[model samples]
Target: MAAVNRVFAAQLAGLPVFGPDGESIGKVRDLVAGLRLDQQAPRVLGLVVELATRRRVFVPMLRVTSIEPNAVTLATGSVNMRQFHRRPNEVLVLGQLADARAELGGVRVTVADAAMEPTRTRDWVLAKLAVRERSSRLGLGRRRSSLQVVPWTEVSGLSLGDLTEQPQGAGQLLMLFDTMRAVDIAATLRDLPVKRRHEVADAMDDERLADVIEEMPEDDQKDLLGYLAEERAADILEAMNPDDAADLLAELTPADQSRLLELMEPEESEPVRRLLAYSSDTAGGLMTPEPVVLSPDATVAEALARIRNPELPAALATMVFVCRPPQATPTGRYVGCVHFQRLLREPPADLVASAVDTDLPALRPGATLTEVTRYFAAYNLACGPVVDAGDHLIGAVTVDDVLDHLLPEGWRETGLHDVRSADPMKSEEWERA
Candidate 1:
């Protein structure tokens, strides 16, 4: 009898897969599930992996020999992602998993009914795979076949999972619990080897956790989300980026979907609803609710006071947002923003508009970053502001915040490099949620 901490092969889905050198190969993308229904030596005989670089690869059982906290050791010195056949009955590819997602919020998006053209020709064609839908027993296009292709890429496989049977040993029993309970992101994030990280979105109970995972690559996010209960899925969507959240909501059935949106607080739902109303690719669609703002009565000093307040939002500062007193318009209302440094240099009695640096570029809430970037170069502003049709301020986001999209993990949590910026954060400035 081994310790319970050790996961059996059947329980290893969603565990972190590692490399021999102890570096991460990335999580196990998904397990080959259907084939085992007949014989059941193990719940899964193989794992379909989508790599960080956007490539899809396959790993059969038997080749795996040892699993550890950081790596998955394989029996063969050479591992090919595609050597194992992805039988439709035992498929674990991206296209097979996306059909499992549940929609919530008022947002709608179609998962790609496509598959990655495997590019194993290059010893390394690093890529990232995105999963968007679920799969079923029936073949494609049939009423039961909603198989959507998720994306993935490859990394080196470091070690085997659980090290259950040694390189020289065999004899194991397969146990299948719900996939949701079997995988944990925190446990996965800890990079425990032998256990591959599986998509278990439906398994999670915490909206905040789901929200954090939503910011991850789609395949991983979709996997986690698929395991969730419908309402729980909605809760996670409610806590996500509006554009992303809205997109998922649109995928749900009308009934299960609406119930989840209704579960959200009005403020969260409103932005997601607003995002849902826009054309996905248009400036109106991609723009976030974050925009710079100013209070009409706010003197340059007072405005600087807000910027200097460490507690003001990190995402908001990038745009130099100004706050209006009660009952302010949402857009086109600010006279303009003054330079933060200029406040101290100017005379004490200087009028705010006099200090107004109007030189800073401005943007409507509908403006996309692509459109706003030109202004950033033309005017040299750190970022731009967004406004509603009425010209009232909504939220202010900056380029750094925009850069969150580029980060391996987005800015939901401040990272190590954020220290200099985060140092300015003040507890007093945050609006109580």
Candidate 2:
């Protein structure tokens, strides 16, 4: 994962969006977002994209690679060109997701596998991974192992510092990440406005910042989301725990839901769509998307091999259905599946069928919401799989999906009472309470 770059909804409001080759793709126009309230962090759902033709487009956050003051970047240069060449609303949302699946989204933040360890040796040795035939000839003893050093090659992208690098007495950061760099300070404005701080924080290249901000109360999230476009807000929500994703989407309009889902892949969107389709209180409706699938006759080595493919996405990976054959209709009956994570704990050659939880509870088509709720409460089950009369896996219902439906009107609330002004800090007073 790379670091996430950020900017306030206000600053990014009119930033020009650019292609990788620095072509002017368009500019940021307005931010589409949910409502918010008192001193809250924000959530972004999407962006109102404006092409050079003066046509406005709705770009979901996932498609937004980065947000800088002068320019925005996308994961791909060719985003729905067919639609872009057409008029507004003619562009489909799914095309953006297809682009994202191809790794089109630009860097939201810059990231590195970093550690916060203190070090002693100022002088250092380096590895030349980028150079061919450079097999790390520089050798150091174990005593030098603790020397603080970062592999320069590991840096994938570098944010162009504000066209100036003058060493100042007090440093005025373009943004503040948890990371500290050895640089001369220009000037530190101790009294920068909170809104400014929020905007500056948007430039941070930290994925964890969003998480920590989101972990605050809904009121804060609403405020923060107010500073982001709806598409970006939706991107963060989609990346969140499924439970949070459902909760956030519930507060959005049907049109927004449709738009956001269109930007998400079928693998990620389909299950949440299923979860959203339920009454938040039923088992057929409350099952987690994650499931255990298996090849009915798979050998231990085969089973182990599947687990090693981390590149395989989560929803697909979680399914361990032990069908008689792999990836097709089975000749034999559907056998049991062992949870992939737990498979390693047992004897290496243990068959999946023999290792499965035989007494697993499942849901039928017509199970009542109350009955299913009781099953979860009494059994502490995350969810149960739903099967037809033939016992073939049809779908699942997770507990969070149930809450999305069962929770009172409060669950969908974005907690933003609009302030008097357009900006989040100055919303309508009626929106405040």
Q: Which candidate is the best by lDDT?
A: 1
* Residue 19 C-alpha lDDT in model 2: 63
Q: lDDT (0-100) at residue 223 of candidate 2? A: 57
Q: Find the candidate with the highest TM-score and give its number.
A: 1
TM-score of 1: 0.44
C-alpha RMSD of each candidate structure in angstroms: 17.8, 20.6
lDDT of 1 by residue, 358-432 (tens): 655556666665665565567665545555666555434455544543455533222223323223323311211
lDDT of 2: 0.43
Report the error of model 2 at residue 340, Å. 8.2
188-235, model 2: which lDDT tens digit per residue? Answer: 111122343344435533344344443444554555555666666656
By summed lDDT, the worst window of 10 consecutive residues in model 1 runs over 168-177
For candidate 1, give the lDDT of residue 224.
55
Total colliding residue pairs, candidate 1:
81
User: CA lDDT of 120 in candidate 2?
Assistant: 34
Instruction: Give all TM-scores, in the order shown.
Output: 0.44, 0.39
